[model samples]
Every structure is written in C-alpha cells, then in structure tokens.
Target: MFIDVVPNRGSPPAVLLRESYRDENGRTQKRTLANLSKLPGDVIEMLKALLNGGALIGTAPKDLAIERSLPHGHVAAVLGTIRKISLDRLILSTAKDAASRRFCDLVVAMMVDRLITPRSKLGFVRAVDEETAATSLGNLLRLGKVKDHEPYEALDWLLERQERIENGLARRHLKDGILVLYDVSSSYFEGHCCPLAQFGHSRDHRSDRLQIVYGLLCTRDGLPIAIEVFEGNAADPTTLKSQVDKLKARFGIKRVVLIGDRGMITSARIRDDLKTSSLDWITCLRAPQIQALAQGDGPLQLSLFDERDLAEISSPDFPGERLIMCRNRDLAMERARKREALLKATERELARVQANVRRKGSTLRSAAEIGLAVGEVVNAKKVAKHFALDIRDGHFSWSRKIEQIAAEAKLDGIYVIRTSVPKGELSAQNAVQAYKDLSRVERAFRSLKTVDLEIRPIRHWNANRVRAHVFLCMLAYHVEWHLRQRLAPLLFHDTELDRGRAARISPVASTEPSASARSKKAIKRNANGDPVHSFAGLIDHLGTMTRNIMRMPQAKKHPFTLLSKSTPLQDQAFKLLDLDPMRVQ
Candidate 1:
C-alpha cells in the first residue's frame, strides 16, 4: 500500500492511502484504502515511509542523534584513488596472509597519510588512532590501535621491497627507444648521525645543515620510475652512472635515450659511462661551451637567431653529435638586467673596500690585508669574472671587464642542446622539446620537496630509513601526479597544454594559458559555473565532506555510520575519479 496525492481543481490536493489489487481479468488496479488528506503532512509522510518498509526506530522523529562526525571526503578521494590504481597490490603483491596483509595496509596508510596530511611517523599514528583520529582514514583502513613504532617498521619493509616495486613500475612505464628524464636534488638533515648526511652543494640553501642528495629517474612526461639516494656531498654527475646501470641492468630497459641537464650528463660522464653502452643522450652545453661556440668565426653566430629562435649547428669539438642552438629575447633581456644590477651592487661594495684601504689611519697595511678586503667584495655577486682587481700593500683598485661583459651579453638568452640521437630518429626541433621536457621532472621535485609532500627536514638516523623515507615521498608524488592529471579541469592547472603549445609562436616561447584557462582565472569559475581551485584548495574543499556516526534512542547500543551529503562539485570530483564516496573503503 502507498499514499497517493491527486490534484483537485481550485482546491488543496487530496492525499489518499491506496493499495494495489488484481481484478478478475488479471489487470492491476488501485483501490483507495483511506483519505489521508485530513491528516498532517508529517503523519502522511510517516505512513508512506512505513508502507515502503522503512523502519522507524524511535517514537518521535527527534529521537535520532548524531554521535560523531569525521572528515571523510578527502580520505575517500585519496584512498579510493590508491585502491583504484592498485597501489596497495603494487606495494605487496598478495594480501592473502593476515600478517603480510596488515603490513601492506600500514604501508598504504603511510603513503596516503603523506598525501592527505603530511606528518611524522609519531604524529601520523596519533592522528589516525581511534580515540584521537583526525579524519576517517583510520576507520576506512580498519587500522586499529596502531603503535608509534609500526610506521617505522613499515618503512623498513618497504625499503626491502623497493627493488621489486621499482622494477614493476619501470616495466609498466618504460620501454625501448624512449626518452628517460633524470635529475638530482638535495634536502637538509636535522641531525648528523646518518652516513648519507654530508654537507655538499646545498640545494635547500641550508649550508649549515647536513643534507642527503637523491636522484629521480622518470619518463619524459614526468612519471617517476625510480629514485636513488646519495651522500650529501655527492656530485650531480656522479649520480648518473647508477641510474644508467639501473635502466640497463636492473630495470632491463635497452635502447633508451637519457635526458639530463648539462651539469648532470657532463662530457666526462658521457665518455666514461654512456658512450660505451650504446645509450643516447640529450643534454645542454654549459655556459663555457656555449661561449666557446660563439667565439671568433665559430658556427654558433648570433645572426643564426635573427629570423628564428632555434637553429642547428655543428662543432668540431663534439664530433658526430648534433648541437641545436636556441635563443629567447625575453630571457636575454632578463639576464642583462640582472647582470647590470649585480655589477652595480658589486661596484658599490668594492668602493667601500677601496675607501677603507686609502682612508686615513687605514688598517690594511699589507698586500694580504688589502687583498683579503677586496677578495670578499669581488666574488660576493658571483660576477667576479666581470671585474678586474689590482691590489697591493696599502692599495686597492678595481675596474669593470668591459670586453668580458660584452662578450657574455652577446650570448645572453642563448643555449645549445647536445644530443646523440640520429636526425632520422629525433629531429632538431624534437630534441629541443625533449630537453625542455626536463621542467616536468623539476615540477615533480617541487611537489615532492616543498609544494605538496614536504620531503625535507630529514630526521632518520638510519641510512636505509632515510632512503625509504625519500622513496615513500616519491611514491606519494607518483600518486599525486596521477591525481593532478585527472583533476586538471577543476584545478588552476592548464588543461589545454596542446592548445597552449599550438598558440605559441615558437616552441621556445614562454608558456601561455589557453582561452578557457584565462577565463577561469579571470572569473574564478569554470564553464559549469563552479569555482575553480588550486590542488590544495580542492583537497580542502573535499575535506569538508564528513562521515557521521548516528544512533537512535531505541538502538543506541548499535550505532550506524552515515555519509554526509556531498555538494555538486564534490560529486563531480568523484565522477572524474570514477569512485563512489559512500563505498570508498
């Protein structure tokens, strides 16, 4: 039986209780059981619900209560993505055994925790504990009563499986005749205990702090494949060999082209590590090498870029290799501006030193003293080569190296791409594009170090622990990269990358957003009139969706979990991910 409302002309609708019955001819007909029109609307709805077989637990509607609510939408999005990608299985192949399965759960939990709210091991455990849970992550993963040391143990187990896991990823993403992008980065350490923590070129600008360097090997489009940690003082070039060997021997990939910056794939490393191996390389020429190419009667003349931003040239020094030269007017102008600014600043500092030397009762009485004062000012700006200094006992003089500065200015905004791939295999234009693709790897590093993952302030005292920590962060970024790709439309990230490239006058031109992206930026709304957000903003917005624990006066002892209603935008995000927030776990 059900309640049916019938419209009446010029009067209130008639609400009637009705039942379905079969007549003698076997046709279905509805019969009015009672007139519910005189009853209140609430009572009528209650009767309808009861007729539909929905149980009413309490005597009154107000008897039901919400006991607890936890942030759940963000958990659902991230954890759902992890499972959707089969990242849990990737970490540990089969969870049939209870103990291995639980360990795998802990590993997966640690990874998602980094994405959701990056916390230390102790803090993560406290955040996911049943009583002190910050979100629905604990309940969703069913990770009950986690101890502080369990996370560290999970890291140890992950480190042991790093090889197998990375090999699996490499096989999935890498192939023969592909461009493999590689780069190295460093993060400062909090203590001096770990062997890998040594003071080297501090990319974090924390020269006072010990650090560890790590290299990331990725596909040309920036999907992380493998990562290797090195001692803090390790040189960038020194880290390339292991990655090369890993691709050739460990990952079992052959005939791949390795792309790196000039500092990484140096001439020496190439001759020693890569040249003998049948591997190809795509790297840029260092400043000195570019300067050498532009010297008197050299092939890399400025006129080559008069009508174009990119051109191919040959060099006798680098035999049997193709060199593609590119110039950007904007980059040239910016470099000139910075150079002049630094020169003026250094001149001001040098003037102070000269005055100190010639001032009455000058303390600089010897050449050593005068040279010491002058030396500090010259190299402070790193444009010391642009200045010529004359220092003697109780005297100091300085002048600009005009010829040197002019020569450098001529090469401003100019760079040369060096590649070993044949012209048939990869054209000059494509090679330049491949080298430019290094920025994608750089973007991954930014997400890992500061932007999203915060893979810094290393506190692990064990070498393997430190390695596992960085590896975990890399895996987290791998997940984030996929998330960003799927969520690009809702984010400030440019969705029409191909369109933007098409709009550019030259491949070397600065990037510009497409028309649609510009509109989104200006109006702060997408085509659907929904607000566009940054990745972080979108995550926070999803966090607003919660899971509530509900109970009633009649069934207070057996509370049920209920998902909060999701907004349209949240629904769209789930749609994009092809996930159901209610059934995430």
Candidate 2:
C-alpha cells in the first residue's frame, strides 16, 4: 500500500491510500484502501511510513533538554580569522612537539582573549577554565585547565621567537621600494618594578606614572609590520636608528621609503642616519623651517596657494629633495581659533598674577618672584614667543606680541612636505598623501591605547615579558585589522574611502566620508538595511550564538553537542568573514 496525492481540477489535491496486485494472467490491478484526504498531512505521512516497515519515534522538549550552552560564534569568527591569516603558524616555532603545539595555542588563546575581553593572565585563565568557560575559545583551542603561570611562560617563549615572527610578517607585508610608516607612542605603567618604564612625554597625560615608549612600523596601507619597545626616557628621534638597522639588517629590505613625522625624521636624523643610506624618506617641514621658506624672497609664497592648494617648491637648504607646500583654510581657521583661546586663557592667569604682585604687602615683591610667576603663565600654553612681558620689583605688565602673532598667522594652514623620492617616482600630490598617511599610525596608537585593545597600565615587571606583552597586542591588532577590512560592509567604517580620495580636489583638503558612509551614519544601517556596528559591537553580537549540549533523560546515555541556529545577522557576519561557525578554527 502507498499514499498518493491526485489533483482534483481547481480544488485542493486529494490524498488517497491504495493497494496494487497482479492476477493469474499477470495483469495489473489496484484497489482503494482508504480515503486519507481527511487526515492531517503529517498523520498521513506517518501512516505511509508505518506501512513501509519503518518504526516511528516521538521526541518532545521534556524528553530532550539542553544540559549546557556556551558562547561560540565570536570565537569562531576571530579564531577562524587567525587561522585564515596563518597568524598561529607565523608566530609558532618550527618545533612540532605536542608541547610546542600547546604553547602556540596558548599564545593564540591569550590574543583571542585580549580581543574578546582584555584581562590579566590569571583572569583569562579563570574565564577559560572548563567550569567557568566564559567563552568557547578555551575549549575550541583544547587548552584544558590553563594554569595561571602558563600565559607568562608563553610570553617568554614568544619573546624568544620575536625576530623570526616579525621577519615572517615583514616578508608577507613589506616589499622593496614600498612606503613604510613609523611612529612612536608611550603608555603609562602601574608599578615601578620594570626597568623599561620611566618618566617621559606622557601621551596618556599621566606624567606622575612611569611609562614605556614604543614605535610601530606599518605598511602604506597601515597594516603593522613590526614594533620596538624603548625606555620611556627615549626621545622620538632616538628610536629611528634601531628601526633603520632592523629594516636593513634583520628584515633584509634593501630599498624603501620611510615615512615619519617631522619630529622623528628631523634634520639631524637625515644628516646622520638616512642621508648616506640607501633608504629614501618622506617627512614634513617643522614650523621653523616652514617659516624660513615663507620668508621674503623664499620659494614658498602665499600667492602660490591662492590659485591652488598645493605647489612643489625648492630651496637651497633642502637640495636634492622635493618640497610640496600645501594650505587648507579649515586648518588655518582652527589654528587661529585655538591660539585666540589659549591667549585669552593666558591673559586671565597673568592678570591674576599681576594683581597679586601689585596688592599691598604682597609676597610677590621681588623682581625674581614676579618674573618666576610671569614665566609659569606664559609657558603654560607654550605661546611665550607670542607674548611680551615686563617684570620689575613690585610692578608687572604684559602685552600681546602683535607683530610676532601676525608673522605666525601668515603661515597658518600652511605646511611643506619634504621627500627624497623624485617627482617622477612620486608626484607632489602622492607625496603629500604619503605624509598624511601618518595619521594611520596615529589611528593605530588610538586603538592600541584607549579604544579597542588597551595596551597601557603595564603590570609586568620583567622587561622581556613587557616586550612580549606588547608584541602579543600587536599580533592581536594584526588579526583585528584584517577582520575589520573583511567586515567593513557591516561596520561603521567607510569602505568607500578610496573613492573619496580619488574625488578629493587636493590632498591638502580634509578628507570626507563617502556618500554611502554618510547614509550609514545617518540611518545606522548598511545598504542592505541591516544594522551597522562598531567592531567591538559586532563582536559582542556574534557572541550570542552558542553551542548547546543536548541530553535525553530516559535514554541514560551520553549527551551530544549542537550549535544554536544562527540569526540572520550572525549568519551575515560569518558569511562576510568567510567562516563556518560550526567548525573550530
């Protein structure tokens, strides 16, 4: 017997049960067994299955329950990216021993944890333990019962292989004659035990705390190539030589264009380290140098920017180099506004000091005392050169250095980009753009210090561990950088920035986001009408997908694991990442 459906003209299809047999003459015959049209569709199907000698079983929520569930999708996305980029293999040593494998996993786990939720080593270990299991990262890596000290030990192991790992990254990302961007930033320390931490220009504005300074070298696209740690007391320019040596001696890059800020690629550095070397460089002129260029009879004329925002000029001081001068009205307005504000603030403070000096029986009576008080106020804003002050016993007066301020204002919004690369190899526009790309390094510093990956408040005491800690963070950022590029469609990041650059009138003007980016920002959604997210927010949303352990109470058997069905958004994320959330990376 079999169940079949027959069409009845325009009416609903008729469901029927029938039987077939053969007579003595071998002729075919059939009979209607039942009119199953009145039965529910599922019931009819079940009847057909039973007639075909198939056993039927029932399952209900009460029979099977979810015994355990853990967050898994985010782990899959990030860890999957790590494998996609072969970061694990890049950082791992050549040793194939089981311990080496586990250590590699440990390093990867630490990096994943840092991206997911930055924590202390002990805290990370606790989160990944089988009992706690805050994220599926630990279980996915098969890091069973991670010890508290293992992460530190992994750092030690990683530091030993830092050169090899960096060499691998450089080989992957760097090429001869490419633009290499380098910038330095400092992060404050929590304790005084580490030898690398000391007082320096606190980018974090924590002068009271000891800090460590580090420089990041990146490709023209802003992907990190390598990083080096220095004593917090190290000046920005002082760190350039070691990087030069590393690029030539270690990474074996014969020719490249190094991009640095004016502070890093100073005149002294150029004359000493880079002038005689094969490496070319791109940097901007300092305020003093720009002032000299704009002086009377100099090459950089104010009228040069009247018709256009950028011009290529030359001077005897910078021979055998291309100088690209640029002006932006917006920058000029902002600088004028800030200078006025600082001047007003300084005047107010100085007026208070003058009142104290003139008051009867005032403590600020000596000329030395009055001069000291006046110096503090003028130097507070570093506009002392723009102010004129007079100090005498029991008397004080101040006035704005109008001529000087006017001289400085003439150069506002004006900057000169200097490069050793020739005009044929790199145009004036591209040279200015290369100098502007230094902002990418600045953006990386923002992400490293305060935004996504917090690399500050150093607690490790050993210098090597400190170095390893920083390198690990850089690796984590490396993974994140690639992930962001892949997931940019779903993110608030402007994926059409290159188009914007192409549309820009001049490289000197401020960059504007693409129209699509503007729409995304206004609507909080992408072109597909899905919600857009910051990188962190997207990671958090992906964590909603979980792995569930299912059990049958009556069977008294072992439980089986099943992944929760992904939401549309979660599915879209995995698709963008080209990852399978069900598979462990």
The TM-scores, one per candidate, come to 0.91, 0.92
Model 1 residue runs over 4 Å out of place are 1-15, 18-45, 49-62
Candidate 2 on 1-585: residue-level lDDT in tens? 888788999998888888899989999887787778888888988998898997654455577788779988888999999999999988875878887788899999989988888888888889888888898888788788888888888899889888999999999999888899999999999898999999989989998999999999999888998999999999999999999998988999999899999999999999888876777999999998999888888998898877899999888999898898899999999999999999999999999998999899899999998998899889999989888888888899999999999999988999889999988899898899888999999988888887888888789999999999999999889988999999999999999998899788788999998999999999999999999999999999999999887877755588777898888989899899989888765
Minimal lDDT window, size 10, model 2: 55-64
- Can you give the lDDT of residue 239 in candidate 1? 96
Query: What does candidate 1 score on TM?
Result: 0.91
Model 1, 435-495: lDDT tens digits are: 8989999999998988888999888999999999999999999888888888877887778
What are the lDDT figures for the candidates, one per model? 0.89, 0.90
Worst 10 residues of 1 by lDDT: 498-507
